[model samples]
Target chain A: MSERRTPDVLPGYEPLGAAVRTDDERWPTASPDGRRRLDGLRCHPSAPVWTHECGDLLTPEDHAALDAWTDGLATDPPAGDDGPPPAVLERLDRLLAVVPFYRRLGVDRWEQLPTISRADLARAVADFVPVDADLSRVVQGTSSGSTGSALVIPWHPLDIARDLPLLEHLLSRCGITWPRDPSRLGLLNVVHQEQAFTYASTMTWRDEQLMSRVNLHPSAWTDLDHRAAFLSEVNPQVVSGSALTLMDYVDLGLPVTPLAFVSGAVDLSPAARSYVESRSGTTVLDLYGLRETGPVAAAYGSREGHHLLPRTIHVEVVDDAGRSLADGSAGEIVVTSLENPYLPLLRYRTGDRGALTGAGRDRRIVGLEGRAAVRFVTGDGRTVQSVELTQRLQQHGVRAWAVRQRADGSVLARCLGGNHPALREAFDRLLQQPVEVEPVSGPVALGPGKPRRFASELGQ
Target chain B: MSDPLTDPLDHSVEGPDLQAMIGRLLAIPPDFLAGDVEAGPLVNDAVRLAGVRPAGDEAVRARGLGELALPERLALQVGAWMVAGPPLAPLLRTAPGEGRSYDGESVASALLSFAGLADAVPVARWTGEDPERHEEVVRALCRVLGLRPRGETHGVAEDRWVAVGSAARRAALRAAAEEQRKAEELARRLAEKRAQEAAAQYTHV
Candidate 1:
């Protein structure tokens, strides 16, 4: 596959590098090679897919509403100041005062906490929560609970509001200026869950009419034609999902073009990165977030990595012994969300392993291996890495099904409908072990909760 | 499976006393409830609602029991047996022999089963009455069965099935929407109150 690598690769893009003056200016600073890649990946007009109402993608009203919501926190651009701003400090003070758990963790400011891990937070949930706080308000949002211990979190409206500006700011860095009307624009979301995908379309939060959801579940799309048709129809300005899912489009000669392509939830392979940029002709921005904390870090000017949203969260990369790792050191990522007071999550350890890169004064997190526990294991006892499996499955025609491993070592693969023999043969050859393939005879089963992509016999 | 005198489940199949029937039902495998945590209440409710009684060789229950049929004679009642009552039974219920297609009975059984398995899920008390929503309910139920509603059986039943399916979905959606609306309202009110307090402080100057 490297043989196919294009000769024209962009030079390193460091958001905090010499080329970028201030962190906020990174969005406007496009790398020459990044621009070229963005130009090359435009979708050819051979396919016609449904266009969601333009109002669904963006709305002026929504922007106005968002701006109004953040008016209280909006501060004048630094006035040449750098450390934590006064407004940010004030917000931090309030968060510390209101969220007793955060106060107990001693995380009063954005820089106070270290990177967090899932295990650390689960322990906190047991101890930190005010004995009287109704546990249900802060619901647990987990991408993978391979271990019975999943991150149980509390939801807070203030937290979501604070996180949005940072997300929008990061998005702007990658050329996705949130149009006043989301419905007027096109969208293709490549994410893991059904709620986020559907919410992008159905829900009227902020009134940004995100009317369409061309949900490309990274592991579900397999046919090149389907992929092409989907991109052609949506013509999204922003193409976002796990890095691997977008690369599959590039791999299959499907259009990889978007004004900005954002990847989250897994480590983006270097080869996959090059393929995506070369094909889509777009700058791929990195998004750092976990199920517990929605959107924490986003890439700005440099393709180098993501910058922390110092307003909504305090980011840290901590070593295993609960000590903070120096910049450029790899360890578990822990996050103390300054926003979510409903169920304040302090020093929440995201299972994903990552490290900060670059030296002092120019530090940012560049290396990340998103959650790997959410992967499927084949009968051969080999792990079908989630990111890789998604690419392979999306390349084929399978969509929307559950894969469960029975206690007896048999695998049950369910599909809404797809070409079975080919899928079976692909899995057989891929797994290198013969396994029984059973076609689901009815509608794929959905329990009361969010369905998982892969499950082991022991239960997740 | 022959009609044995006095079912093996009890010494005499004759009208199972309330305690005896409840005990037999409890003995049924937990998996029969699909490992649902709420299965206890659902089974209890359905049994209570059906008011199963011993009469002759079969349980002397109301014939035309709504729209479904009872097990007549069985050691333990399955999910399918829960729907063997009025209106819901006839449109969607499925007897063991009624070909794999979903009848109202299966849908009812599934709803009852899910109600037992999950917590506070609105399976029994749906809010609306739309055929489209009923169809969605059936589709949702089928997902639980691990079956794709396709072939001739897909969307085969008529108006009643659609109405019932729609009503179920409408109820669920309405409840979800209501919950979301309430949360949003509370958030807004809190923000508003804070803003007003801030304003009041400024005015105090």
Candidate 2:
């Protein structure tokens, strides 16, 4: 076996064995101008040492398959209201044959199959994976979003690369052209949290353009002021982050501006979207998706609702009984996504509420209410994002929890399983007040519908 | 054991006759005969005795009835014989055309007619919890099997079967509890493995 060499640009970088490209096939180095930009980013007073490593890990065969898949998306007609298209049904049939979870259900009809929740995935994720899937190339990612459950999803590099085409399609729909600029960064993924996995990598699909995931928290940098300076120096073509992160970005008073902003992970309110767009002088595309289902829909600038993005996915609104409701009816949003070859989601309940309006290409999810963007104010008058609390609680190994901040600035927290006193101490330190941490039996005690992970009585 | 047909003390057989007695016994639900008995393995056992294997391996199918108590064993045997229908012919010790006095195929045919009637049995005396009620069903099965009751009188036989049935039911309950404990232990181990795999990666969203 040939030994792999670490590049000088990515400090403390470790390459994964699952990467399909050999050391010789990797990009030799960044361009001369790109190297200068990288130096400025690395030399920033507050830049954190890159801690984790990842790559596209796509092979030549995967590239060819992605091209064909994207081309098919462009040529295929919009899905009608009748039922699942033949292609989706065919995939479902194959899924039942290979996936143990679906085979045990023994249901041929798509509607008859029971809806699966995040808790189900948390319990036994291997059951959903196909028996014939290639485990050698699989990479794992955990999602402990606003939902109290932590699910580890096994992802294929090819599946993740497909997100590029979907984003390109969304960008094209808005008449935005993303030209390749070797000098400037291609994309900047921002996260405003106490701790996160920060990395810089070259986007092979975007012509080896530079991309990085940077945390905006003070601890991630040498100084707080460097956040704006580092962002200005990168000058990415497009920036992507959650609604809360973008709000933080706007509040930072940064001088740099990108062509567009992609807000996801949680719902983006109209007021927040308008503020981000006006402040940055760019359009804010509110994306609706979960880590489990890639990119599902996007709402353009000032649009009332989100339009469906992928042709392969079948989105629906279903009642509590797992029966599909009428188009205009409001219910939990369920999706049958064919994106991940390793995990074929059949009627996977997303635990978000929405209404499906119109059909085909004009289909839009109106009145979509996903994870609430909750911000808690500490006793010291400092504002704390719920994501920070999520990081702390997860670090304590709290599996499932819901936290609510009362109007009095006092907090009440409940968790399903974890070290209770440790969790209480963690909360008290974050909120800067004596917080009550109650131990609960199950997810239902948290609340009805979706477990409201974080709720605030301190109104927006 | 003496043949009930020749036994002078087997007066109960003369009153109801063999077919009527078998019909009555077949009419009782397996649960009514013995509390909390699983019929799946009993049916599988009967099928296996008739020379056909079920879906799973023989060891797995037999594990359900393995080491069962006396009342449970007797209940399963009677239940399996009742469910055997026409398949019980080949399982009979006497082969057809062997110059045997009794025609095994005719007896098997008689049992087949009463096969599915187990589900239609009424709750006349079988209270499911009372061993004395279960004893009545066992006495009827003894006559059908051509064996005399062990006791001198009907009341004596009923008393003995009740004591045995009661002990078996208690053992069955204990076994069920132990099986449940084992299942819970397995689930706990599976949950630990899942938690380990989830934390193995640094990727979080």
Candidate 3:
């Protein structure tokens, strides 16, 4: 799948709204003129996927080729020694100048601004948004939150488009490639806690075909025997889902010879990672990212954390003052997208925390802790994740559930179950908590639409 | 599915109507009904505020005021069931403080059970499964009940003979045949039931 780096020619292959089996073919080398073109895009604090230290191995020729390929892509911007894209900075400066909250804070650059917390955002919701800007132009998306609250994120299409290649690249690291025919790819789409109607297709090549079907609410991980039966029936070539969902598939003892298994949405633990690999034999790739920033870093085959996508976006691990933190030092991840302009975020603090590794532009990401920690004690005396409990809950008709840990260490689950009291008794004994069963009268409001597999005290 | 003799119409069953009855009962004014619906003010309040009349006035017209059809008060009950259909406002007529605790799903499930789609198995014994099997049983009983044709003139002399008639005998014959088919199907699989029973007896001994 190694294709020769080409100049402005690569940009010509801009994602045409479909996953193509190309991008693996050889192309021309990056020319100096093409590099200039890419640099022109970078005129405003923009960083293309090619300029980072992690991309240090990229030849000057490769950089030139990519620059020429993406000359006019609003998303393809040049990387700076540090900080956000110039355009992003300009927009932030403009926003700060006009927006009262920022004006009161006296912040010109986002770097000077204190990182906003979710609580703070909720409190200052009205003041934080631009008043004159038309929200209609922003593409609206919803996330079914773990806290049972729905969040609506308004962004431009370009910001959404940038996330595609990042996901494709992360999938590639785990050996997942584009389907032979993009038109026929069928994913067992998951919308929050419920599974959609299963569709059938004949695509079957483990690497070439992309017709693998998926199931929603990956909580079926508790019963390996049941999951194995399902996998044996569906027989997908590739499987990518939430970390909690993938863990459930592994727990189900299903045969795992998939080309790639991608994990996201929740933090994947080492024990959970090993369990999936051992069970499925598929390399598990952890994607460190968010809805706001797309994918930041993706795990390489070596499982040494995730490799930051060079130049696609600039990364910063900074102190509260927004000063760049040293490698291996923990700080909030701040990003400035060079490509997407619909909602230009300059130094947008990604609420997640992680560290940089390697040196210079070659730095990749190491660890990230986003969601809260939850453990499950297996019958084998092994402590797993609360994700397992949720997975098991899914196998029954329970489509939604939330596990709340009280101060006393007792976990209470508010769920939709036909046999509520019985399930409560059974789970109470299993989890060593006072399981209070409250039968929900209707379908649980699973938020706007994003599936949240794990809920914790963190980022509450 | 065609059994009619043991169906609701055949039996003089005394239970609430499948629709409108419960919702209407829930809508009765607390002071007017003497709070017979619930023990305390809260439950009574919940029921009164429920405001659930019948789905429409047509439903009342069709079902004769549903559960409110007392021996001498059928006319009043029938009048109350009919009303406007929308803004969905007229659908319920409860007091300010009283509202329904039962949501739509609970009401629908209850209705299904009343129609024999769901069985009356006690919660202690219920496994929450095999609703189709229970429905089949109900259907079979309904078919058995339909064996007797409408008697001539609705008179006892004719009705007695109709119950003992050749047509009734033929229906009984058909029922017996169907039952035997079911038993044979079981026998084909459980040929050693007697042996298993004998073994169980020995274990007890």
Candidate 4:
């Protein structure tokens, strides 16, 4: 198939190359309405020069399956017992038959099977993929998790599109409706990072509602003022980002107010949530999930905890020994999800701490402690968020690290497995302080269990 | 180190001939099979007979040999014994007790089957790469020879053999898991590269 040409409406369109166009041809099934929505986003004066090309790439069959799956989600039965439900067990059996990793273990019972950790995925992801899964449609996204190294997650387009309905369900529960409005952007995914994959796409599932992922970092825009101008003009109905990014949005002081703001990736304190809600005149919902596991639960308006979102996921709190902890006991958050066909995770350990309250459809994750947004004070008394440190550490290819700042503002970072001399220099430059780098042999040296990646004693 | 007595092991058809051959092969006195031997001497003998140097005291202490179950400890000893020795094919053909005769190639196969590792590992790997399952192999060897180590009752011997066999099966599964991990790591790298290339074209939120 010939590559789809960029429409002339996007005068700032700058293609990365023709290579991107080979498999990323415009969605053949895109409705005319969807095409117009895409053009509107591209033609907006506030839009950055298009750096790359992409679309929903959802086929007619994928659309049908996604719709059925989304529609059934509301009525789907809640998880059963401490063990996996019958359906999940059946899927596990199928996985054992085809997935090499699970087959090699020869574990038939759920209790006997070992829990999978992020390290396992980072080391050998293909082992978990079923042999029969179609690789033709696989797309990848990198997730720089709060605790570990960046992981490249393989995603099916249908799985990516599934987030639309999941979001809609969350919104509807909060009494918010996202009607098709061409004048306003459907959704805006904001990220405050040194660099990010920024692009524009129409949500084909949501009647081609316009959506885009924009980096809030100043480097992403031609003028620093464009950040506010773009947000003001699009006035996105739903804004999604990490709690840190949402705080940046509030700091931006843009005139645009969305119906709701979705905060993820980091823990959102009540004060911070209230701050964003009051500043933007919008409700802030805390979404708890990892890149490996899609949206698991969301804390909506006045909700005591994060209400479970997907019916296909079974959440459990497991102790260090991987035994299931009773409800109300805080432990590592483990999930068994059938969300992605390409990667069916069984008893996947998320490394986040939370307690499961209630049972069945009423299950909620309480006292959820994800990656805390830690701010490090530099030598000059300047404050820096852990996200920036994460970016720097990831750039150095250092995995499994812990960065701690003493009360005197001295930074000490212990990294596992590799000797990184330049990492200290990188840290020194990032924090504007002389940082000490210690190379350790294993994860244990970083500390017990999952280490807290960032900590500051400066009382920031 | 071929002795005339060991040479005719392949032709031996009687249980007594096989018993004599086993004594010569293991370099133990014929009556020693019926006597109790201390574990230290047995371990040293096995290490010496296998033509491999015994591990240092520190290494042995680190492995906690004294803390391990008798079968597990024996497995380690037997593993070191067989790791470097000549093929057991000739002696195995003359093994008694079950009224079974194994061909040269099938001796290792038979041992592997007895240990529940027939499908999980090849004879070459069991002999080489895997020292962890060596005791299980020795237990299977004893079952074929119908020789219970001296000082142990039949019931005790039988129970230890069962325990070692179970350990071997678990080790075999772990070996398979390791193999899959390596293969999957390679596959994951390739898949990751392809995904990166595809993602370079276009990515989602």
What are the per-residue Cα lDDT tens digits for candidate 2 across A1-460?
Answer: 3232221222112222223333223323334554455445545565665544445555667768878888877777776555676768878778865565554333456765667767557655665777666555555555665454456677667777776666677788888887778767788788876555576666666666777778776756766677777788778787888888888887887777788788888878878887898788888877887778767778995556888776577888888867888889999988778878766787778888999888778888898986777889877776778877776676666767788889899888888777778778777766776698888887877767566478888884
lDDT of 4 by residue, A113-212 (tens): 6677776677567767776676667777557775456677677778777877777778888899878787888888887654455778777667777888
Best by TM-score: 4
lDDT of the candidates, in the order given: 0.41, 0.61, 0.39, 0.64
Task: For each candidate, report what fraction of the true interface contacts it reproduces.
Answer: 0.00, 0.01, 0.00, 0.07
Q: In candidate 4, residue B127 scores what lDDT?
A: 36
Stretches > 4 Å off in candidate 2: A1-46, A145-149, A394-400, A441-444, B1-205
lDDT of 3 at A387: 42
**All candidates: CA RMSD (Å):** 20.3, 15.3, 25.8, 11.4
The CAPRI quality class of candidate 2 comes to: incorrect
lDDT of 4: 0.64
Best-to-worst order by lDDT is 4, 2, 1, 3
DockQ values for all predictions?
0.01, 0.04, 0.01, 0.08
Full-model lDDT, candidate 1:
0.41
**TM-score-superior candidate, 2 or 3:** 2
Cα lDDT tens digits, model 2, B1-205, are 5423123234332122334434545565545344234444554555455443332435433444433322333344454564344322243333322242223233332222222112112122232454454544544344444333432355554344345444544443343344344334433433442222221111112
Q: Report the lDDT tens digits of candidate 1 across residue range A215-264.
A: 34322234535656655544565656676556654555554355667676
Better of 3 and 4 by lDDT: 4
